[model samples]
Target: QAAERLRLSARTMHRMLRVARTIADLAGAADIATPHLSEALGYRGIALAGTRDAA
Candidate 1:
C-alpha cells in the first residue's frame, strides 16, 4: 500500500516499519497502529523538508 501510494521501495518500507514500531512501543502500545505509522511518516516528512529548506 505504501509502495503504491508513495512509490516507496522495500528498504524504505522496512525503515518506516522500524520507526513506527519504536514509536508505538514508546507510547505503550502493543502494536504499530495506523496513527503510529502516520506520525512516523509525518516526522520523516518534516525532517526531509527542513533539510531541503536549510540547504
Candidate 2:
C-alpha cells in the first residue's frame, strides 16, 4: 500500500526493505516492524525530494 502511494519501483521497494532490515537490526529487533519500514520510507522520500522525479 505504501509503495503504491509512493509509486516506488520494485528495486526501490527492495532497497527500502533492506533499509528497514538494517534499522530493525540496529534497534535490536528480531523482526522488521512498521516503524522501521516507515523510517525507511521517510528516508526514501527525503532522497527523492532533491531530484526531478520527486512527487
Candidate 3:
C-alpha cells in the first residue's frame, strides 16, 4: 500500500494535495477544480466499496 511503500501514515498519504494537483493535470485542466476533487473522491469511494464487498 501507499503508506507502507511511502513510509507515511495512511492519513497523511490520503490528505496529500499534491496528488490531487497531479490528477487535475492528468485530466488536462489548467487549474485544480471541484470536478477534480469530485473525481478523486469518486475513485476513493469505489475503492472503499470494493473493500467492503470483499469483507
Clashing pairs in 1: none
Give one digit per residue, the lDDT tens place, for model 3 in 1-55: 5447657566745654466677889988889787776666566668779999999
Per-residue alpha-carbon lDDT of candidate 1 for residues 7-50, written as tens digits (9 for 90 to 100)? 87788778888999999999999999999999888887988899
How good is model 1 by TM-score? 0.83
lDDT of each: 0.89, 0.92, 0.69
Instruction: List RMSD in Å for every model shown.
Output: 1.3, 2.9, 7.0
Candidate with more favorable, higher TM-score: 2 or 3: 2
For all candidates, the clash counts are 0, 0, 0
Strongest candidate by lDDT: 2
Give lDDT: candidate 1, residue 35. Answer: 98
Evaluate model 2: give its TM-score.
Answer: 0.83
- Which window of ten consecutive residues has the lowest lDDT sum in model 1? 1-10
